[model samples]
Target: MSTVTGSTTAAISSAVATTTAAAQASVQAAAQSIISGSTNSSMDTSSLVTALVNSKTAGQAATIAAEQTADNTLISAYGTLSAGLSALQAAILPLSDGATLNTFKTTLSGTGVTATAATGAVAGSYSLNVAQVATSQVLTSAGYNASTNLASGSATMTLTVNGQSSTISLNSSNSSIAGIASAINSANDNPGVTATVVTGSDGAHLVLQSNSTGASSGISIAISDSTSTDDLNKLAVTTTAGKSISSASDLTGTDSSGNTINPSQSTISGTGWTQTQAAQDSYFTLGGVGVSSSTNAVNTALSGVTLNLTSAAVGTTQTLTVAQDTSAESSAIDNFVTVYNTLVTTMGSLTTYNASSTSQGVLLGDSTLSVIQNQLAKIVGSGVGSGTTKTTLAAIGITLQADGTLSVDDTTLNAALQNNQSAVTSLFNPTTGIAAQLDDSITNYTSSGGIIQNRTDAINSDLTSLSNQQTTLTAWQAQLTSQYTAQFTALDTLMATMNNNSQYLTQLFGGTNSAGALATNKG
Candidate 1:
């Protein structure tokens, strides 16, 4: 009996423990009641079955739970590390590409003049004097009756400005002065000309203005009258034959009727149109040299520099100084330092160990995190070249700290940008710069299918595996419950039957506390 019991105990120990103490206790109570011959045949066989099943599967269940928890924590830790790396990447992008360091600022000593310098602009000062601003041409026609028809039949009016011309056909429908103005204003192929009608006491006058400002943007109109009676010839203006209305001498010409046209007696000059404003180019001097532009916004005068001119700046000399934008460079470097320090802090927290408290970070001693930290530190501390050409962040006021962070010296940084811009450029060059090196490394560590993601994927796969194990354990538990329920139920009935037989014998042949039925009858 002892051997069989020991073997059974060994088998039970081989399985796991997942059963509640209450279920085991209920089974024990039922067995005790049967042994004591209480005549109670009912037993909590379900509790006994549950207790046995849990015991067989508890170990595997605990193992799966532990592994799942560990995998999930590792995944979360990698997520935090990835976020830190991405932030560091963003902070270094502009610096890595050399955009931040190549910036320049423009300064002008006078008002009404603004300038901007692009990447390739040279750092220097130049004296700029605005002689005149560009002006657009304006031509006003002689007044005529607004409702009177100008074209006797179908005639064409050609409007030309800046060498481009548009011709409109006029008949009885649009022959009036206002109709002609509207037709010119609404023509789809109209050149650089805007037409408007100004109604004065003298009747309606057609005004034509150039859309652009320049010497070449003068306006000219030629009228093709269909017949001799057509009044469309009254709007003809010609700049050919040196007969521009803007000339100092009053232009002289003959009217359509072969009559001598005098400027003093007519509102229109002999050129057939009155000049309100002459088209002219903008004139400015740079370093005592003359420059001209068709527009006030001048970009071609200086390389990588554009000057915005205004009439208020005319007749005055101003100084334009182009220099490296040290402020922006400094700010960018400072931001890099700040974000790098934050990354360092995050990494430190992730890998921290506390001997006194007997505790450590979740990702403590992770090989991937260690490699990333070491590589970043190596790049940040390394110099660019060898020997005399060697340049490091220290040369530009950025230095590595004892706690694995960076610090900046503003005065040194500004002076380096102002005086030794080339050295700064070399230090932050796009291909071999410190920021570029770090950016490349971070991309490898945090980008899609990179180291961090690979690790996270592995952990997720492990979690799935753990989940499968849990499912298998659950199935095994169910099987154990079914088997145990039948065995325990049969054993319970056998025990109850044996207890009842013992009770019947105790009553028939009295033993210990009770006399037998035959002995009581003899007494």
Candidate 2:
């Protein structure tokens, strides 16, 4: 709307504004870029450091993955070994050469058995020499006078053991048959002494017997306190201060003999504590026939254990048989198969790769996985050392599933155990069976180019290459952005200087020209 000169003035002002706006925009863009770099794009190093640590083994995912790798090896070994063992029982034969006639057996009749003299027979041939489970001895010190209730003569008696001694004493009130036993037992109640009251043809007399059994249970009592009738004939107290048997449980003290004695639990019923006789060989029973002890025959050709039981004295050899547990063996085989299948599947997942996927997921369908599967499949079919019977797991009850998993055939396994157990034992036991064979195989494979080892090596190599590429990409992006900023900033600065010079020239000409001089004169 203004005249020509005014329009020119407005145009110059517009140019200055445009130039200043351009410079401001360029400066702002540079500032924003620098801020953005400091806030988000610059390499802070902390994140990369964390990533490296995570990649190495600090993070949960990496640590667990690494640990699982080691665990798989050990678990696979155990599975292979267990699957190969043949089911068997303990090797020790029951009731063998150590057999001895322990019990006297007879019908309801009071008739006794005729004891035969064998190489092991101790004293009598037809009759057995059985040790006393319990005994009562009515002992009266030779020096002791029953009528006077005191030591009548110079007979002496003493009980000593373990350097401690207590002379036997009896009060007149305690002179009664039961009373004397009660008093002696009370005094010797500490450990080694076991005295009880028993009534027999001799009336009630204090029965003194060693509580210990065999050579260890003893009763040592000397005649130091002896009188003619009351003198102890078994033991002699030395001139030294006699240490008496202080307790019922002490092994060193006894009544008269040099036997160790320790009294056991005392009950009120007839079932009082008694010395346990040495356990002798005894026979178990079967069919009404009394199978003689000799029938318990054990044959080593079977390589299995045997337990022989007897019923009676006049019996012929009646063999008893123990069986191997087929159900358990089947279950164990099933577990091994299950775990093995899992391992196979896991291995497949590890090696298989999908070409369609741009992202790496699983390493399935790999050569390493195939090798692992082949090695494992061979284990079930493998044989043990010269095995006549037990060989294949499938022969017992193990079967593979459609998805390459395994299932146990319990029915077949049970039948095998019932029909032929020796074969089963040969198959599983490691000492001579396939179970041991598996251990050797696992050891061979996991050594170096083993499936797991080779796969791990490959994955690690790939990770290293991927990491290097990621670093290069980030650095290239940063360099490109820096180049773009430099080019744009230089162009903005050049535009700002040109616009400023153009404004300065327009103002100078308008202020000093002839038109300006004429205007001033008219004013």
Candidate 3:
């Protein structure tokens, strides 16, 4: 009996152990199946969620790409058009004004004078005789040792020229003649006076010069000293009754015209310096007529010619000739033709459609661009002036080619300018000519709220909408992913729970065999 009891207990224990092991294996398999997902009864949640979101958002992504591409193309097209228009505008400028059209070339006969001609210069010859060039007033102080301080304490000096006056302050650094010269030069309110320090065999001295050249303008200086016997006063003859430097007068000087300054008791007294050279005006003759000018650059004698007199002699003369500049007019027209042809070619290539090549330009078949091209053609083809003397561009050698660009006949254009300069002037005058019309048209297309700007703005707006939609789709995809993941995770947990319960029941029943039967068999 004891042997049977022990055998029955061992058989039951073995059965229970086998069933428990199988149940655990099943529970693990079920958990793995649920987490991995399957077909039909279960769902491949991750792939489905990604596929659905991608399918819904694909159209929006494609639209964004298309808008971006279109915007890029529009930007490129507008930039190219603007560059061409700018070039055309520059070409139009030289021909628009009457003053620019009446240009003249000037020639000088000799080295004594050089002349420049302006638009108003009438074609004529002029003889120029330079008698005397202009001069500036110069005053020199008596020589002193190089290291001598010209200032005692702080002193103020006044310089007057050309009805203007400036006060100069002397400090320690500017106590010497050199430093004083620097200070005078650096004074902000100084009208037309300059100072310099000159070194001679004897010693250094201060020299003051007026920048104004004529007799009407000269330099005057007065000094007031606060310390000691006034350094500036000591440097000159003392005017005070008993002060003992030279009693003679350096303050008594002559004007630029050699007129003497009358001596008076109030006049400041002398230094050893003398009036070396008097300031004089430049004397010259224009067109055989005697003329005088305060400056060497004589502009008033001739209508538009400014004569820069380089030398002065009593009988020496120069001939100034002003003539029409036909070559300049021809060159300007030629440049216009060249630049216009280039602009037309660029725009043509952009707007044309090619049957042979599959590629199309960014701006091909654009209606606004087509209208602009038409307007340009009309402006180029239209007659320039009102009269019946063949005022159209064809008469001036600027003709439109079949490909819609301009061509220039240099000989014809030059001949036309020579024959009728006024007609040419009227052709491009900004007030009432073809160039004015073209300018107005281009302004409408290029300025603010213009056609090109409006198109660009619309494209930008579309791109912005596409960008916003893409953002919304992206957020929706993330939400879908989270929702799917949570659903699948919960399903997996439920499946695992059911599997665990089945395993527990199978172990309790011992897999279709009773525990008692197994114990009896062992007996």
Q: Per-prediction RMSD in angstroms?
A: 8.8, 19.2, 17.8
**Cα lDDT of all candidates, in order?**
0.77, 0.39, 0.67
Candidate 1 C-alpha error for residue 63, in Å: 3.1
Candidate of highest TM-score: 1
Writing each residue's lDDT as its tens digit, candidate 3 over 1-523 gives 1111221233334444555555455445544544554321454455555555555454455445545555666677778987888787777677654455778888877776777888568888777666566666666777877776777678877877767888888855576878778878999998787888899997888887778766544566667776656556543322221111121342245757998852211223456344444555566667767666667788888887787876534457777788888888787778778888888888877766666754556677676678889988988888775557446787777888899888888888888888976667668676867667776777888888988888767766766776787688778878867876787668756766676776666655546554533444564
Question: 497, model 2: CA deviation in Å?
Answer: 2.8
Model 3 has a clash total of 1
For model 1, the stretches where C-alpha displacement exceeds 4 angstroms are 1-51, 141-158, 163-187, 195-207, 222-273, 356-359, 477-523
Give lDDT: candidate 3, residue 397.
78
TM-score of every candidate: 0.76, 0.39, 0.71
Q: 396 in model 1: Cα distance from truth in Å?
A: 2.4
User: Could you say which candidate leads in lDDT?
Assistant: 1
Q: Candidate 2 residues 1-523, lDDT tens each?
A: 1111221233334444555555455444445543443433443233333333333222323223333343343344333332322111111111011111111111111111221122222221112211112121112222223333333333433443334455665443455545545655677433345556555553443455544322222333554433434323322312211222222122133546765543321211121122222211222223222111212331221223222222232223222323333344454555555556666566544444456653231333334435646755665556544446436666667665666665677688677766865556656664545445444555455556755555455545545554555466456545544554465456445555655665565554445433443454564
lDDT string, candidate 1, 1-523, tens digits: 0111121232333332333344455556655544443455566677557655655565656556655666676787788999889998999988999888878899999987999888678778999988677778788878888999888788999988767899999987798889998899899989988889999999888888889876677777888886866778878875422222332123245668988752211132434478787676677788777787778889998888999999899879899998878888888888899999999999999888666643467677787888999999999998687789989999988899999999899889888988988888888889998888898899999888888888787777877777777888888888887888788778777878877788788788888999987678884
**Angstrom error at residue 494, model 2:** 3.5
Q: Give the runs in model 3 whose Cα sits over 4 Å from its true position.
A: 1-45, 97-99, 145-159, 166-191, 221-271, 312-315, 387-390, 475-523
Candidate 3 structure, TM-score to reference: 0.71
